[model samples]
Target: MYSQEETLRSTIDKSLKVIRLYDWLLNLYVLDFFVDNHWTKLPLSWQECFQNITPQDLGNILSEVPTKHVLPLSFISLIKAVKSLSLPRDKISNKNKIGLLLSEDICNGHPRLKNLFLKHVKLKKRHEICLMSKVVSGVAVESKCDAVVDFGSGLGHLVRVLAYNNNLYAAGIECQSQLTEEARSVQLVHAYRAALERILVDYDPKLKHAPVRNIKHSDTMTFQQYSTQALSRLNIPLPACFARGEADLRQWRRVVTLYTLRLALAPLVETVILLDRVLYILEHGLSCEIHPVFDPKLSPRNHIIVGKRL
Candidate 1:
């Protein structure tokens, strides 16, 4: 019999296989971490080269067959080492921007389908959204709630995944224009493609049915419309009300000042969600659990937060 941890990992791995990009990303994430810790040291010239490349150019480079499989390991190690060095946040940000550009470039150089696959793939980070989603779903299943609301949704990825997987009526509140725009773009691309596919593909009893419906793309709408549209598209009755607003961390008694600086746009959220900070949620009438979804060891903040309305 497999341990719960092994079972969870197996489930995630199987799910990941369905999405080529996610599969590659998962492998890359592990490989990158391994290389960063144990592989060849990256030179200053290579670091400069990485900083200079754009996403499209990086995509092109990734498209070509690598001379050695071990090379990625060395490159990833260099990135980690650089991050470890005493550098200002701005410098790190610049480096990351270059890395993203490289990633995007590599993605673009791939086939259209592969590009689409990679588009949804994201680096594994300390995200509570997945755990929060599961908790919300479980609570809803028990209490028969109408919808789940995610506040301060960055790129709306969590909401998207929840609605897609659980057929839940969900809404996201996003304050950042850039992240909102990106989320909207992703939503449109996937929604439009799914709509087109449904129109073209005839129903077949032999094929497995797709679980998620096309999410309606709207800008700055009331929570009601968002929930209604998501439910209506899936031919489900609308929930009475959807969840709204971002999670609050202002109520936390003890929190780091650096957290405020990090979450300038959404300051009162760190203590409410961060792993080291999640105790506050429990104090504020929420339950906490560390579930296996992503690699937790990669970051201390990867667990999810589940709160029931008191």
Candidate 2:
């Protein structure tokens, strides 16, 4: 078994390598994809690699192992390198994989109290709270934490489950008044349809139509049209770049490709953030371990840094 110091140091080293190698992708602003001329920033080889790529082609690149996808040799190599450098995200052990907790778990299985706390919670948030609460419960039990303090607790979801279901002393701090009051609240679809729609409408005046107030009928219209209408309702104007033809088909595709590349590095980026916390705790002579307590698909930011004072 590796010592805590050894594990953290090694993980930090790999994370830094990925960060340094793809600093450009990490730094690029997704919101400024059109304005920044981001395609010019990509390596010429990488630009050539993804220039003629299709939607399905980019999907294959995003997978864990691209067995059937045909990509340039360099792109394949980059993917492999990234995969090799990323920390393993699987559950640490069966010991850490505790069952999820709910109101029923703490409310003595009372049916009335079962889902009251979960009233406004979505499936993803429900899954996360159940899993993470159990993990935090375990860590608190192990360390005998005086009281668990949750930062950015927004609506106190996790802490609620932790304190009630797990019977641990917990407190939550939230800075956002909106979230404090009610702690609330993807996809590459058809070549950035919404972005394309905004640009196309400006590019061709004939497509323009009055904005609709309700987007509930989004299914009836193209995403671009729906988004344009929605934005119009809010009196938000499409960027001038779209009207100028600055962000055209080629730029859209490049932006998607660049975004996908950045997605590939997301795990490494998260690791760097989580491990930096671990390293800081270690510096202070506290024990720290990152637990992959939540499902990655359900909760992309699944790693939890648990610290214990030595």
Candidate 3:
């Protein structure tokens, strides 16, 4: 008979195996990094978080992990446990940093689900982003919009995807200086790589007919070029202008983590202003559409609001 601890350990081992297999297929480097740097270092609390996950939940996670699903289920249990303890804000200070770093790396590595970081909650599968983006784009087209604004643009993943793939004029509003700087840096790096690749493909005759490599390189190159142009045209000025006289916005509930709260507040404020602005545009007989993206998992509060003006 397996002891309770042994049972939990076995379950975790199996689940991790599945996760590793999935990561191997989609982005092995992420798996290597997680295993090498953080897997063993996970705190007891974190381990318990995974340990407590229901078998059914574990199975669901296993099924989706291989497909590169972006759902928050993997860590949702832990985040909830941490929130329940009413830990000091500083205790969980690194949570946002870890999440942001992980999501950013995942975005850079996975071409299929690059915008996973922008989502407030984790998604169950990669197709969810496609589904959500399609819905939002449809709403925008129906509204006949000229530009889209993505609030709380984590690593600017959604902005990059929409702008690069759809050729839409989009802007991402982020409050964290570190994240903003990183986003800008990623865009620059991707652009330079893309420019180099284009030069290579155009001049390297021996490698011109390598379809598989060429296609992969071309896709990345195209995405990078699109990202660079979109980022440049966005004109995202630093330290987004906030409402006057609200410097000590600390009055806002310090729930979850400061990073989480800050990310949350930016969109909430942006949504109110955006909705009103869109309403006014509609009232003025302007052709435009407003589409909002929301994440159901990261607390019922996760939301992404976009207003498109035709």
Candidate 4:
């Protein structure tokens, strides 16, 4: 057992590595970053936010916006503020460091699931989860919750990790029909494959999922036999990663929104989206936390807000 102050000190130190950039904080308010040309992969939700912004609204915001000035947080200042804050001892204890490091038990468990699940998840998507896992696992453990709800869980990437890897009851709430359906399909395939392989191979049962050998399966003497048996028994459907069907590029663009391409080029909406998501979690009256997942220098999307039911 670690003292709360020890955990707080360590987490603050890790977050501080990039917290001084205070400039990154300021960028959150800059509107041009969202409209800038460098952003190429604007997410579906971002597209919605963009569409929601009226021309008149944008004009007024742009008119008053400075060429460059955004502000959010400072680690040192945070420490000073914490010292000055006169909150009750109970409340202070309740507010554990949001970014506690991942314990080996959760972070390193189910190595097979980590690798197998990533097969269908893209590289960039996997990278995001790697950063997310640190905070997610820490929050889940600290809050001691079995259920996790990912807000704006695009394509269910984080959901996949939580459910299959951590053996948690995780669900993603994505607004886009295409993205939600796609994630559901992918999860079904990944789960079926993992179930099949685990039963056939001798693995560490101490991990999250123990093998249920009695479940029906084909002989696994060879890959061909296993594959056939899996198909016949599981009848699993692969995700878009497995087969590329003819797609109307134009329609798909409209589905994801071509605005994504332009949005990525500028990436100004990122800070707004980040702050909005964090606030959205806090407002729900759950035990919520805000923590930096990785070094911001590596990926500005390193911070996250995790909420656990009280």
Q: Tell me how many residue pairs clash in candidate 4.
A: 15
Q: Candidate 2: where are CA atoms >4 Å away?
A: 1-3, 65-70, 96-106, 180-247
Q: Candidate 1 overall Cα lDDT vs. reference?
A: 0.39
Top-TM-score candidate index:
2
Q: Considering summed lDDT, which 10 consecutive residues are worst modelled in model 1?
A: 245-254
Candidate number achieving the greatest lDDT relative to the actual structure: 2
lDDT at 102 for candidate 4? 34
Instruction: Assess each prediction's global lDDT (C-alpha) against the native.
Output: 0.39, 0.66, 0.39, 0.44
2 or 3: which has the higher lDDT? 2
lDDT of 2 by residue, 55-168 (tens): 577876667535454556656676776677665667655654434333236443556766777778887788777777777777777877647898899888788777666777
Which TM-score value belongs to model 3? 0.25
Per-residue alpha-carbon lDDT of candidate 1 for residues 77-101, written as tens digits (9 for 90 to 100): 4333323331111222221232332
Model 1 scores a TM of 0.29
Each candidate structure's TM-score, on Cα atoms with residue i matched to residue i, is 0.29, 0.73, 0.25, 0.33
lDDT by residue for model 3 (1-310), tens: 9843344345445434443433422231221221133222444444444433444455454323443333355345433332332112221232123233334333335565644444543443323343345555666677776578878775666666566655578799988777534232222222222332333343453532222212223444444343244334333331232221122122222111222312322322333454455555555555544332323343233333343444
Tell how far residue 266 is off in model 4, in angstroms: 8.2
Ranking by TM-score: 2, 4, 1, 3
